[model samples]
Target: MMHRVAGAPLAFAALRSQLEVPGDFAPAVRAEAAQSAQTVELPPEDATDVPFVTIDPAGSRDLDQALHIAASGDGHLVSYAIADVAAFVRPGGEIDSEAHRRGETLYFPDTRVPLHPPELSEGAASLLPNQVRPAVLWRIELSGDGSVRSVDVRRAKVRSTAQLDYDGVQAGLDRGTLPDPIAALPDVGRARLALARKRHAINLALPEQSVTGDGAGGWVLALRTTLPVEQYNAEISLLTGMCAAQVMLDGGIGILRTVPPPDKGAVQSLRRAARALGISWPDGAPAGDVLDSVDRSDPRHVAFIEHAVALLRGSGYTPFNGAPPSQPLHSGIAAPYAHVTAPLRRLVDRYGSEICLALRAGIAVPDWVRVALPELPEEMQKADHLAHEVDRAVVDATEAWLLRDRVGDVFPAVVIDADERAGTVVLDSPAVRARCAGADLPVGERIQVRLVTADVDQREVRFERADSSQL
Candidate 1:
């Protein structure tokens, strides 16, 4: 089942109009920000001194996480300093209410509505390089096989020494001459890389595209996770988040980003899809595991991954105010998980971090967090819907524009979805699903087809069989 439904018709102009502040829309999170807007005293820059760097987009204002690696007793320890948004925004205050209402930072190709105001998100709480800021640090110890041995989270102040981008990191990692700190920790990097390959061996290989700021005129659609280091860095964050979730759940209360296991019927459908694509599977393995293996080995794995995407459906925000719920873990991550990082971009993380902090301190979970727990699910759902709509609209529009003039051109495409009765086929690249125009197309098959028509104005692309020579 396709759980990610088609987006509603909410135009960018309308959402922009709604997000406009009312001239005095909670200028700062508190009066302290107003008092020393010029030169506020900040935390020590020891973290920044140790070659801590930020790895985000080209022109991101609110940097959320920074990393620093140092030698430990036997191995290396990773100090991950995340922006402490929970400290700045008071619970139930005006700014807090606004953040809660917003629920998350919604990003579109043309516009973005940040979760917190710029003074805090882009200034005080941001982990900008060379600027010391308060941070909630997670110190994790990693074994040689990439297993996390010990984990610690606490309130601390830190700075980021350098800011790095994905492209730069990829280039450095490839050339084997990365800058000082990142280059110094070869074992840590190797462990992280090994861990990433281990994860990809089991996790679903889904592709993601991010619309980046073009800087000159508009935005450009770029596929994320193309580089190996992208996956490596993501695994670090995931390790921390899973550890935090475990800490909270073990203490008897915590919210989870939960997705129920794929249904047996859904798994069976995927298995049939594999057979249709001429891929073999073991006798009694789990569907997810089989799909992961096929994705790694099969030539048509791109299309197969698309089909496997349908198996895991309906992910949602589940709050555990009183006790943790009995549910299967997220099959994609291959572990139980929750969102504790990126508090600057997400509202739930602020409260979630507070819960974790209190639990670690052996104190009762704050009443504010407990009382706000039930409302979190619905709020997060709304924000998620809004974000998805924005993303799909932008990508759909861009692809339509790119293919507007090449209507009759033929290109190799991996089949994402197909319907025999409707004569429909969806391509993986450009993500345009269209009708086959009077013929049946098999699902999970790859072929070259001509674009019969493309209407950029209508956001529609149509396809047909090309000549024998071309096909």
Candidate 2:
């Protein structure tokens, strides 16, 4: 069942305006992007015969990475083709300056503020099927155990055989009818996941709350669970990123996506919550394993997973030159990582890819990249903050709209979090998570909650324990 809201577009527009989100490209930027799209040069190396396929959300036009995996002497060769935004966006050019200011794409429920003009992001530089586009191709050689043997990145002209989506790919895998180019995805993904677990990587299988357009001029708020194939696809990207981080570290200059180790206090809190929720977290078992072992469909397990999100709080971009940062690890991955796979949407990926390409080719890092390294962290942080705010606001507004007509009605909910005065609850139907106020609210237990206020204008939804308030 879907919970829908009418006139959501107006609210979204107001939110965008209030947040000062970038609206449209300047005339010069648009002209530059259009001209580059028409006259961009393709790389000399031809990888069109590799039969690469791209997997992303359905109807995604800004295609980023394409992949083709095949057997190689009891191992696997993963040919990953990333959109070469550098080919079209000259350093210090109009697109480059604008992308730096924006840092990354800002997504909304109704639309997105793209980092680059759609001419390049969605048309020319995108790795669309049947179109020969310039790409930064990573030829990753992995052993039978998913251990990396060698990594090579270079510019090339590539054509994707098909543009697949997560749902279709998952269905194909279940039916054993996936195409030859990506048939080994399951095996490779599993191997990489095993390696991740061995390293104590933290993988949270949390349900995503998203707002989508309803058929008629309204919006629907829904909860989505990650499919197995999606996790497999993510493993491939993570593999490429870890390899990129190693190359940059060896080369002695680049930025990294870093996170400090999870707080000791947070881990303890999660362990206690797990016990209260009746989830089996074995003695000394890493949180990731316990999370992976839970049944995601259960209310108590879902509540436990929600509490575990505290472990992923302090992620940020860490740029380094000549000397590495003191804390270089992304704690969740339990390894050093770089963002080099999605140049079409993110500003840093383009720079990170350039560093890897030059390092792999035994050349000096470009002067433009060196000049921009120190500033990237701040820019990306600003963008991250704005993106988070926009996402939260949209969800809040949608939740308010969903419950606007049902004020005073009661629903079954699981108290996922609690403190002295208030807490948070997750409703089973309509998939709403909102603030609740009551004395001594029980954590990790199912209870009845009464909707008190659903203020769409304020983008607030609040509830009280059903027994604490009288209708």
Candidate 3:
């Protein structure tokens, strides 16, 4: 059954206060924004001829990327324009220091703590439609078989023709009514996916749960499924990041988003869980392919994804000064990658993009950028930890709010993971995942569980095995 909460403040506000998230920008940061500075020396070359458009979630104001793809000699040409935040914020200035402190934007159901003040991140530096803006343009050329042939990055002035949300783009794709630039996406996106599989990229297609106001003074939790075009559009960003990593690696200096390859023991444990769940792993199949074969909507598949998280642990930012780091690969993407996208939201991307631009332009990297690289990994790592906790807390609080009134009700659930002390289970009705304390819980088997406790303030939900035959 669907659940609703009314006449109460969303727990996210309270949670944010508990976590000490800065609700407003510091006075210095705000005062600095009034005196906006421009840093680009050379005149930005005009690229407004391209019918570039922004694709993001509905109502997303702080847009980051815009693109136009076309047919090249054999494969395709992708002209991706990223917001030129570096051009707007002076290095080592008040805004720069504030952004470095924030690291990245933290999102929640009701509010967002932006990395930069709205006057810049959502205004001057933002790539909104019909507004001419400076951007870091990446003109990437791919071969006939989705192999990258060439890449060029430079400062340019561009104007977006349209600001499109993902839903609108998906609708256009479905009706076969998209313009040439948008229409050409499936061809390149499919090609890129093929290349990713060839390299064994593990792209988990997990459904995200989002809570929204239902317009009747209440909240509704919605599961947003990943769409084909969304995944394909992401591939373009991945391709650019891989190219950025290649440039930095050859230049012998940059921070890489690194993760070690999955441990043999972790993979073996997942294999055991799959067998017990009655799922087959084809003999000699790569991990990515085996993961792709399962249906994400199945409860057992969700369990499998949870188990696979163990293999993808130890993700971190590794900065190298003299030589490339020894562990340089982001095992999740099956490539050595640096974050050069989403500079408006992430602090590291601005530095990464500047390094790529300097290397491509044959100019010396700025002293400020060089000095900040080594210190970024630590601050970025801490911000990442906070972001993860905030996201989890918001979800937990929302789940607790939805189930607060259903304490004694029994619902069907599947045990996802188990131990002697406690086990994790997913309830069918409210679509909430929580813990269930019990004995002899069968993994991957449906059972009736009676809600034992639902504490809204504590952000907890607990259950125990029940006699389902009574239902």
Best by lDDT: 2
- In the range 1-471, model 3's lDDT, one tens digit per residue, is 345665647767778889877678888887776567343343359898899988998888888899899999988999999998887788888889888888899998676899999888888788999988889999999998889999999989899999998888888989998767777788888999988888887767777766767778777776668888898799899999999999999887888999999989998998998897888898887777778788887878877877777878899998876788889999989999999989999999999998999988888888888999889999899889888888888878888888888898898998888877678888776878889988767787788898988898888989988874646
Model 2 Cα shift for residue 109 (angstroms): 2.4
TM-score each candidate.
0.84, 0.97, 0.96
Name every residue pair that clashes in candidate 1.
none
lDDT by residue for model 2 over 305-412, one digit each (tens)?
888899988899999899878898998999999999999899999999999999989999899999999999999999889888988898888898788889999999
Which parts of model 3 are misplaced by more than 4 Å?
A: 1-3, 37-42, 468-470
**For model 2, what is the error of residue 336's alpha carbon versus the real structure, in angstroms, after optimal superposition?**
0.4
Could you tell me the lDDT of residue 325 within candidate 3? 86
Query: TM-score: which candidate is best?
Result: 2
Worst 10 residues of 1 by lDDT: 1-10
lDDT of 1: 0.69
Q: Give the distance in Å from residue 426's predicted Cα in candidate 3 to where it truly belongs.
A: 1.6
Tell me the whole-model lDDT of each prediction, alpha carbons only. Answer: 0.69, 0.91, 0.85
TM-score of 2: 0.97
Model 2 collision count: 0
- On TM-score, the stronger of 1 and 2 is 2
lDDT of 1 by residue, 257-343 (tens): 887777888878878877887777788766655664565433366566777776668888777755678882665676778888899
- What is the lDDT, from 0 to 100, of the residue 116 in candidate 3? 91
